[model samples]
Target: MPDVLFAATLTNRATRLDAVLATMDGTMLRRGHEIYPAPFGPDAFVAAFVRLARGLLRSEAREGVHIAGAALALEAVLDAGAGKVVAMPMAADWGAFPLSERLTTASGATSGVAIVSLTDAALLGEMTLGAGRGVTNAVLLDLSRSVSAAFCYEGKLLQRPYLGAIGHIPVPGATWRCACGGHGHLETVASAQSLVRWMIGRLVEAPATEAAVMRLTGGRAEALTAPQIWQMACEGDPVAAELMGAANDALAHVILTLLLALDPERVILSGALAQCGPTWRDALARAIIQIAPPARAGELAACLALGELGPAATIKGALALARQRVISITG
Candidate 1:
């Protein structure tokens, strides 16, 4: 029998679950790996978890299951009879353990649950095996539909009650409304959602003429996405290029703040927007360098770079958390 690890990420857009079988020595088994979507909401999340766990748990020895997700979603999983679960919130103020305990008591489960944060998990993965490897001081910026950051110093992740909440920070001169009811947040101007929204607005006001973006989206504004906009920018579409440049400028403001505050050795970008590749990176770098004070421009220019783990970074971080828990239990 082999020890199996189940890890999941529940966010605003979707939930992702991964199961990996590993030997006692921490070597991953070549087979029995799975990935699938678990939609948002308590019922949907729990159902997805139970369905996956039943199929994966069959005839295999269980090591432990660790779930990284939004606070509410983790509570739903614990309520779904995920015995002896551990909950890691994506942010510090995200409450998970109290809700887990209430659900556990109601369900009469004696098993205890522990709580941490997804930022902690991501930092662990980066420091040990990903982009932050061998770096003593660095920052990992997870830029997606939302942005979050984690800090590492002296080769250890700083376990602060609160970490990066860059998404909600207001961007100067930005007019877009954030989902959090704030105006001009960095997320409002730079997130994938914001990019799509800005693109659609541009399309709407484009002189009543069909643009390349309209053609790319097949004349359906609702179907436009951030990746498509990046593709258009890459293909030299002027509107797309302009939109992307604006987004990069908005992102630069946030990065500039982080650099001035932390001055880490490196700032690694990860998530969907970061996947836009060198075009996006270069644009952002140019903006950062331009806006940085002349004295710091040379140094800041060298600090910004893309993450090495690609799309699997967060899930890999979850796996890292599971491995740590397994080791702590059996050490």
Candidate 2:
């Protein structure tokens, strides 16, 4: 019988939880979204997970469609051994919580509950069904409001020493303070927020580009956004281009570090920044090649690619993780 599982994404930034019910082979049975309570915490998170899963199951209208596993792709680092949330940036209330255990108990999930970082889940999703398909070793970098990474080697996800939390990797010239209270980290300039911040700070230095950007953003620096900056860079705005070039260089440094450390077959870029269109993507690819060691530059050039799953990548990754949890238990 095909394995029925429930998977969801619960990020610190969003109020609503997005979930799906599907089989092991990727047949979607039902999907739903649930809002977190006024004060979201561990209990509320567990309740929301159960509520969403049960709601999806009820919508199936099929008696005896037992869910064999459940998983959550969370925007937090979990303890590799105990499945406890060890660190959740910007979500302190959930820190040091045994989320997987609580979720399993509250939801009565049979196989066991898997709580994985959103980055790791995305890596699994891409490897299983997206751009990383057929690749045994890969690194997935999620460059959205923040930057995080995950690594897979020889078809297994590495969970020790928390390799996925690469946001704080120090770049050579990035002295901007990161949200983690650190300076010069990769997230300081490689993330969407960082890119916008960098562009805004440099707007005054480039008068022509500044005027154009003011016109583009209605003369409000506070209202500036990353996509607008990327669009301007694509259109040859000097300031935006320079800001983007810095970001590209920072990302290249991180990617090169991962390539050297993990020796992965591919490096997949995902999240909002990856959607900045082909020009930005190609430029980033070129930046990576330029910084990579000469002999491996050609090989690494072909390895960098955009994730194919888009917004659904994390959800697909959750399901893939849930399947693994189930198999481990059943076998």
Candidate 3:
């Protein structure tokens, strides 16, 4: 019997899950845990989830189950009829994610809180950890790639009583059509996948100083991988340097927007790509300084720091949700 069950699904990709869990030593969900993977679709998924929940109920993890990913996974948790469900945007639309279930989700808005940015095109999602942590204010920001997520914690709960979103940003001519049917969304520019796509596109273009290098490389850019881009950046490739500068600039614009809107007291940055090297960190720092107002910059210094959780931040966040679900059920 596991002490807790995190209904975290693996992406269709081959990356491992236990490797992600192995990183969280301080959190309540470091070891003695179980991760269940389910295929697509909610109806069958829920049946499978109930089976897992039953197993957990008969085991140590019966006390709680934390869920993260698409809304389909969350729906399965709801069907499991567990005492509680913690739906973090572990993926795109974990809590009614994909926004495809607008009607059903709209009715059950209270069943879960959708961490949103009320402002135009803001990135990131957050959790509320109020009295549970005993800290007057606790905030976590997800910088894990494209989306920048945030959480406002007071002790073990959320500060905002209403289901209102905190991060609001507006950008005109965003020119990207979102799955949600809106133009100029933060997801267009800030997602991990989006970042990679943007890098590839930029590499292909190889603007200005890069054109000669692009031609001289004899199509090395076409053969480039994500890791290779970072490696080249580490070795100081001019083209990679330009691409990093552009990516950081776009991200900085989003961060500046977040600061202008939410002004969270403390923020922790996480995201596998965003926090990897000093180059990326320096890029974020420099971009913030360039656009951030001097007064606001000082205020955000103590409160602003990049994510440290690596790729597992989302999973640990899911475990936090699992613990919350367990407590809610018992209470």
Candidate 4:
């Protein structure tokens, strides 16, 4: 029996799902947008569950499935009838894992940055499965559960766990707060939402109407349609261009800050915004050039490369995990 894992992705806004899939190893299989709920249903609630069961059964091997990100999706996969679920939940104590899982070997030429890919919900989910692979000397963070909490580790296991949450949610002053009552988080500042909020703010007093805003940025409804903003910038809109520049600059600063704290060899970025286009990439390089110190920049080469994982990093990572079951039982 080959161990196979199943993961699902419901995010189909402002991005192409295939982008995230670029990072997966050949062993994993990922499928997305296969289920559509009622138009008014909005959430992927019902269909997501259906897909989970189907994917699990579809796998030739009897690998256990693990649902990630939204609890609803997880619930749906569970309801659909998965044999086992392997979730590295933010709420779980990750310190129990073996040492190799905690230790990570950063990829690329950068000797000072970790080439990590991040998505909306489960920050470390993809890294643990994909990039982080089987490294044991590592830490998995999710601010959604607790802002002040993180899973610390020794050589290959949890050493002393404490509050060290990472990932995004809640803007400092934005009314969109987190379920934990905290306003502003790594999600708020760096997420695609950050760009969306910026575009809405630039709207010419149109009540932030979707129709009007869509017209403003070419009819996109994603929380942060950076591409639309990029287009506006390209079309010579000073305000739009400024926001685009600032957003990259801001994100670069954040990365710089992370470099000081964590000594990863390379920082691999996996998101729609990271690959808006050549112009967006250029602007990001410029921003990093200006804000980051020359020495730090030289001493460390943390690149902002686009992740091949597409939009299904989480799911592929999960399914890849399921495949592990096949090897375990057979080997």
lDDT of 2 by residue, 1-331 (tens): 4558999998646366899999877677888987755436778888888888888888877777768898888776678568798876556787789888998888888987888888888999999899999999999999888898888989999885367768888888778888889998888878887887778788777888888778888989778777788889889898788778888898887788788877899999998788886777788879888888899887876788899999889999899988888888887
Each prediction's TM-score versus the true structure: 0.73, 0.91, 0.56, 0.52
Cα lDDT tens digits, model 3, 1-331, are 2233333332332122221121112233323223445333333334443444344334434343332211112211121222222243333233433322331243231223222221100112123222112233434544333343434534343322122221223344456664346665665544445545556676555565345334544656454344445556666777666555555666677666656665555545545455455555665777777778887665654454544444444444444444444455445
Q: lDDT tens string, model 4, 188-267?
A: 54455555665676566444343545676455545436566677678766666665655555556655665567654434
Query: What lDDT would candidate 1 get against the real structure?
Result: 0.60
- Full candidate order by TM-score, most accurate first: 2, 1, 3, 4
Q: Rank candidates by lDDT, best first.
A: 2, 1, 3, 4
Local accuracy by lDDT, each model: 0.60, 0.83, 0.41, 0.40
Best by lDDT: 2
The true-versus-predicted C-alpha distance at residue 303 of model 2, in Å, is 0.8
Q: Once model 1 is optimally superposed onto the true structure by TM-score, how far is the C-alpha of residue 214 displaced, in angstroms?
A: 3.5
Clashing pairs in 1: none
Error of 1 at 195 (Å): 0.5
Residue 173 in candidate 3 has what lDDT? 49
Candidate 1, which ten residues in sequence have the lowest lDDT sum?
68-77
| Candidate with more favorable, higher TM-score: 1 or 2 | 2
Candidate no. 2 TM-score: 0.91
